[model samples]
Target chain A: MDSPNNDYLIKKINYEIKKRNIKKVPFLEIRNNRLQGVVSSGSDIRRVYVCVIDNNNNTFSCHTNNNRKCGGLDTQYVCSHLSALISQANLRSEEDEKFDTLASTTNKQGDTKARYPEVFARFQHYLKYLQMEATIESIPEMEWFISN
Target chain B: MTAKITLKENDHINNPMIFSNDVKLDQVFEIQHQLIQVFSNGFSKLNSKGIETLKEINIAFSTSPLNTLISEAITGLNNNQLTSSNFDLLAIVMASIDGSAYDSLFDELNKLMENQVSLIDNAKEINYTSNTEDHENFLESIKSWLIDLAIMGFTEINMDVLESFEQVMDTLENIPELMRLNVILRGFIEEITTEIPITSQDEFPAKRWLGLWLRSYLLTMQLPKENVQSIKDCKLKIIGVQKYSHDYFTLYTFHGILDHEGNNRLIQIEAKKFTINEVSNNELLDLLNSTHPELFKGLEENLVIQVKQGMISGNYLILEKFKTTTTSFDIYETLAVLFESKTISYNKQNPYNRHPLLLKYPVLCKIENITKDGTSKFDWGDIPIRFDKVGTLNEKWKLANSKGIFGFIQFDNGWWISPVTILGDKNQYIGYTYSQDRSGKNVYEVLKERSNAILRSKS
Candidate 1:
């Protein structure tokens, strides 16, 4: 069966994490895979796969293991990630506002840009690191593991 | 000019009525009508002309107040033998010729004028020729006769009786003003019927005690039946008064069930002298249970009394007497119990989904400190203070030990930490926390006994 809708669910999960202020565990390059009609019991079962990237750019994958699939567990996982991201973003936004306000007061445009180079550089580095992380598990194995 | 009164230099006498010949009277009239229309429609629609005209009037007058003008007007009315129509037009002119200049004065004049009843020429012809040496006593007797006639005519109408214009008027001339042609035209309908002959008017006794008792009853019974019948058979007896501050009214009736059956049943109960908000849901529930034991005799465990305050946000009701011996209590089961008791009758459907049982009374219990080591617990006595800034709570807690009760609790880092007691010893502990603060985070340790047991149980 086609994978469960991830794009919409991911945004919602990210939003809740940010809202709840939940601390993030160490992980990277998260992916949510929705597997429908995967069970062999003449009946259908849906599954969601969670994957994240580490500092070494390695992908770590997990799935909801309970017999009764709970939307709350999926929500909890995404919420934790979003919460960490939100806390970091809040701190960064405050610093950015401060920097921009300070920079606007400066007479030279180049000097102002130079003053916030480290912040811009670190943001770029994190973006590249996130993009470089790879998903190692195959679709067949993911489906097999999700059903089991 | 018919007459010109010369004024001394630096005289600040203000005449509110000053006219200019240069301005067209018709245009001024139109603008004045528009201004009145704007005011009638609401205060929001005041055009530039309206505002300017109002400002001009305010600037011209309001120096030597309108009380003197009113007194002069009263004298003029008596001397000129002016008709009620003329007096009414004059009053309207005084009110509207300027913007709010004579408003307060008019109000005072109206109040003074309402007390006196202006009788018709037929009633005025009854002249007593030196009937008694005491003139005041004679006039009072005449007034009493007039009052009885007025009340007899008024009781015909089924509408709730408020004080009438005649009852308010205190003067002989003012009494006649009530039946003025212009006054009637101004929507002041005759409160009493015209079938009764023009006897003397009667004065209404200011029923302050009755009004207070009714207000107190209404407040105590938050949501009474839709139709609160005029207290026909009701007799209010005062039980006791505490230093003239708290006066209690005890109403006794035969039928005690408070329901929406609309079966005109006589109900009676003893209620304490308290504000409407002070009537706790638990008390109402207890009364209900006691009166109708069949509804909840053996079903007490399943029944819950939910009292919500304000209904929008999360506020909790504490089953006051149900505090546990130890620390834990089943909050979920308590909530379930409360919700189950809310049986919605087909007739009593609430439009706001406000099930009567969902109403929650606020719980304001504090865990008191009894010892220095903070290990002892006791009943809270004083009002607890709330602190917002960091370090304020810690500092205040340290200062206000066993010496005295200081109302203080500090909120910081998504928690309200208060100095509370456990086993008769006082200690600092977390009082409350938001769910948003704990989502995806490890559960923070809280003192089991110190927390709002309901919240802890639910968690």
Candidate 2:
């Protein structure tokens, strides 16, 4: 489930990305229930990882390889690369919701999942090769990531 | 019992003028008899009334007749006619009189007496080359006389007596032959007796006398020039710099070692204190270096830093200065490098939670969107915050929470760090304020402790 302040987060991410002039956008894909990608600038590429936990009202835990330039994982605000990825994730989620509603209304057979062929193809690849796991539940969920 | 006075047939008395061809020798003898009788009677009265008689004599000496008589008596001593006994009587009479009245004559009599004593003691060596020795003996005699007068004056001092002694010393200082001797005596006495105890009542007069004496001595003597020359010739080395503060002055006392004429002595060579506005920074530094070379050397070796360039690359902060560059991944890395080869353990458990590096190098960080007036609009950045402006750590935490930024800021001209609330309405960014402890332990306190530890170890 998306956080209630998820809109605010999306807006903040967009603002930060625009302000920082983040040119190279990352291709975010969910793997093992974690959203991860490689953020690149020219020849330099930094790996970014984000995990959404159900506890703490659906908070996002983020980390970047370039901790110094991107700030530590424990930073209050995410780095520009992470913010860009988050904005993309929110847009993708909204598109998926719209597609789901359109398919339910238009077809009784429920075979309208392939409405956007490109998105369908990407989602299929994420499911098959990435081994994307369903969001699981633990008794006491991890509070925060300890980034080295 | 005719009260007849015996006349000595000395060449000075035989001069053909006063008792010459027209006047009888009996008239001359009668005149001498009357003068002797008057002196004898005066002495008897002086014995009966000491200070009163002296006062009366001072009055008489001021009058024309007695003044003339005193002048003539001084001249008689200079001539071959006056015997030592007669000179002694004349000196006694002159001692009772005011010296200022018969200044030149009295001075002449003093010189004649000095010369007579030298002649009697060292007559065999009486020549032009012995003039220096004679002058030295004369100086000794005058010094003793002055000292005796000073003692007497101090014993029964009144304003009048103090003034009289001052006048006598003043007159003596004016005399070219006695001037140097007077200076030496005054300086010697003052240098030795500076620590002497005195009653509150005596302190003022004593100090006045000393001040006047020293002023006259300095005015008349050329010793200071010689002393300065000697000092210039000596080798001076700075030992230390001591700082003292009072309401009016902040004094930097420079202690030094003086190697003068093969003698080594430690002394407080100079003290320089001026208001901040009164002195330039370069001048103050120069004075510090000159006066306290050793201290300056130590500071230059360790603490004195000239920042050429500071740049942040990734997590590494690079500082370039003194023809050398140093790079550290973070403040911790920098401090580790600084405290390198030392067995100091840093708090490495939660690295991102605290920034100890900001305390040491506040200039290394840059604040985004700083206004033209040099104030930051952001809640948190590397803004220069005054130490006094910083509230308590708990207070800072509240402000930081309100502003949505960490309480970290540079304080006290970047020497220390403190939790600060930026005084701007715009909350531009959500600054990192979270610490694992949840206690009031801010980054500043952690950095301060670590820096102090490093400093202590190095020191």
Candidate 3:
């Protein structure tokens, strides 16, 4: 009951990786009883991409880049983005501490995507990964960017 | 400070092969090669050339005994979606495909086949008079076959398992053992042979696999088939309807129960999928009056009618007379019939009769969850479980579902219900084909909305 463990994560999200075709995680943030992260898009790279989970209530949500309310809430039970976020989250408690029980998945309904800009700011790494931070550093590779 | 984080290794979570992505394309070819070698010379000789062809080609994996793997090889070979398996199975799959394409490989399988005559004789030995232990052993073997199909996935099961399954199914179909799970076996075969697709590397759904049928068969196998075969006339009230399609034709089988002359039976009748050009109830009634005045009362849900000179073929029924009883049945009654009769005794905890079908036939349902844009959702009893909305439920369904639906409902990749005409139901009965919607607006209105949107955008 301490926190989500490898066994629980695998049990909950194995299908997301195999069946839903989730590739890998792009970015994730794990805090007290919550996980927020950006998952690599399984189908489209430009898809709305953010995931949130509150272990306290086992409620979750997802959002587009603009933080518009999206399918992030819809896939709380079995979403690939949530799967990626949970798998990549730092759920392990004090290293040697063994724990049992998982965030019981009751599929509670609610969305907080209205605060997209505010909550979105919490994922500073996500903004960094999105290359939103303008760096004046030049790269020869920019000229070699393949359009196709 | 990034605390000393040690990620402990869990073998099941980490084993790549256990959670493998897919059978490596090279492995598929290798498996194909070894099987071809196995089939080259038939049972008599292994010339190393072998059974290199598939007897049938289909888009998905089947659960039917012999032809399933053969079709799987053709299907997966086409899609390159075969899951990982061991080397021996690779040989079997290739051989299965090869045998299907060219020779009847029974020459090889014949060695594994139980002699039908001897098998039947032994089965007879374990009759009602047989020891309890013998019956247990026999039933265990059958359950074992179910367990095998439940566990071994597509492109992974070996020939021996399939042969045993087929042999047991064949025996059960022919002998009195079928009396135990007759209705379930008929329905289950119809189900598996029709839909099931390729599965990935994961545990087979165990609760679903063991199934209500297994429980029912275990409970009811001891009961005797009532001496009601002598009944000259019987009413075939429908239990359920399933649709299957081939290249050209869409086929429908109406499976139902006939409780007549002190005997009860589960029987299925087949019909082709037909569209009614009639635009109203009066038009349909007129057509019935003109074409087949015998059905002047009109066909209702469950098609309640008494048939004379009816012949029962295995689990199927053939009719000579059709005199409409125009009987009225509740939706709950129809569902109860679909569930085995014994469970109607009622469960103490849940007031409703314990339905064996929590997943397949039973829907954890609430009505009016349909939408105008062709997406569908449903509420499960007290729990408002939201289904993942996908493409094309056809907005027209919302019209029917508004009053609540009671017919063949399915939860495949998409959710749909083919509303049936129950005599007593307040829900306005909509025929499977859209005849009532004369405006043509309601007919397939949202069928191609998504596809058209994609095309228009691309254009």
Candidate 4:
């Protein structure tokens, strides 16, 4: 199969942002399999790029210029991007399951194998949230100092 | 770059009811609330005195781990070198007096020393006869352990978990040693007590607590009891344990309830935990002799009796030489009868069978009948696996693995066979018929199919 289309992915991301009802929708772009985006938190429009997959084999990163602080959009952008990809993959798997051969041979004991990847993604997200809770619990007056 | 801490958006972001950690005290307070809720619900109803005892549990978040607290207390005690043996104990007591009205815990120690003066005096080995002193020492030892556990930074100041380490320790300590043993021996005895699931009975309130306690207790003292409820209700469960452990002596009455009231029934007497240690074997034998001196009067009764009496003197050797006889059937049928009866004792007194000393106690059954199933009787050739289905085993292998069979196997041809089928020379699948074909595939094809299909179906 051909690689997923860049323009199509950007449009898909835009549609997801609207669907999720997230205000200040960011513009997403892709070039040669690399995902790029511009997201602003009302005060600042930061340029971000998901350039490298981390140790868990997930691509999540943000870049900054000389004068400013760390990227605001990095964490959420990564989470949202991964969530959207999962949604798309699930949709495609559902369509693929319509074929009898795909349903029988690949599907073990009448159950589809499509849910595992989504489950893994959900587990990773849960761990991330736990880490966030731990960070919040640690230190005195922990009032979003990084975002601050 | 510089490291910075931030509140995770997920915390209280989705859930409106949950408060955010923006205010530090709120987070700590919330954690404390959660811990209290968990502690109250999880542990309060265990015992009548539980609620009051739980109130005294000290919970506070500390940066140090429990082991670190213990080591630190040990070090502090060493610095003074006041008392070498129980220094660790003194340190724990001193450290845990945070909320008490004491400046220096040395005063409290002084008070304890004065109060337990008799115990301190009787600590010498010569004073071992004093039961009260021994009990005091036991309590003191337990308290020392509890205090050490408490000092181990068991909880965060915010009460991170439902129960503190000290609470867990105290709870385990509170369980009597006997109850603990019952719990530990539960799983092992569960297989033996097939009458009714013991936990299902309303009378067995201490089921969970028993299981937990016995696991800890059995590590210390390996007494034999199968399951906790058997120990609690005093059922066949204890019989199984006694059967497993040979050295320990177990004496129990069989009739459950009405036996307590005025009722005339024969009591089944058996040993549970019978262990004659190397030091006490001679002492035990002497005790048995002295206790049952009447046994000497009945020595003739203990003698083995021949059912078909025969008298042979000079003809014994000549008759043996002349009688060259061979039996058509296996001697196993007769031996199996003796085996089930347990009349075939395999101990120092008997030498024929050298069965391993796996169990210390013999499970004595009241021989009700000689032909019944799974009862206290010998059913001679009802061998778990049938020899009649020996030849077509490979074909009707399905019948071999019936639930009641002793050994079972499923073959590639939808046939399940028993280990006995290996009797057939290279063709091990000698006996068995197929189970009715499901999915239109013959039994053998399904058996040879990827192991998953067979296993999933079995499940």
| lDDT by residue for model 1 (B217-277), tens | 1111111112112222211111111000010111111111112233211122222111111
lDDT of 4 by residue, B273-371 (tens): 222111122333333335433221122122111112211211010011111112122122322343354333211101100011110111222223212
- What is the TM-score (0 to 1) of candidate 1? 0.14
Candidate maximizing lDDT:
3
Which candidate do you rate higher for TM-score, 2 or 3?
A: 3
Which scores higher on TM-score, 1 or 3? 3
lDDT of 1 at B164: 39
Give the higher-TM-score candidate: 1 or 2: 2
Give lDDT per model, in order: 0.23, 0.28, 0.34, 0.23
Per-residue alpha-carbon lDDT of model 2 for A71-127, expressed as tens digits? 433324444554555555555554344222221211122111211223222222222
> lDDT of model 2 at residue B42?
29
Candidate 4, residue B311: Cα displacement in angstroms equals: 43
* CAPRI-style quality class for the chain A–B interface of candidate 3: incorrect
* DockQ scores of all models, one per candidate: 0.00, 0.00, 0.01, 0.01
* Candidate 4 residue-wise lDDT at B94: 21
Off by over 4 Å in 1: A1-148, B1-291, B294-361, B368-459
TM-score of chain B of each: 0.16, 0.19, 0.33, 0.19
Model 2 regions lying over 4 Å from their true place: A1-148, B1-153, B171-235, B239-254, B258-459
Clashes of 2: 0
lDDT of 1: 0.23
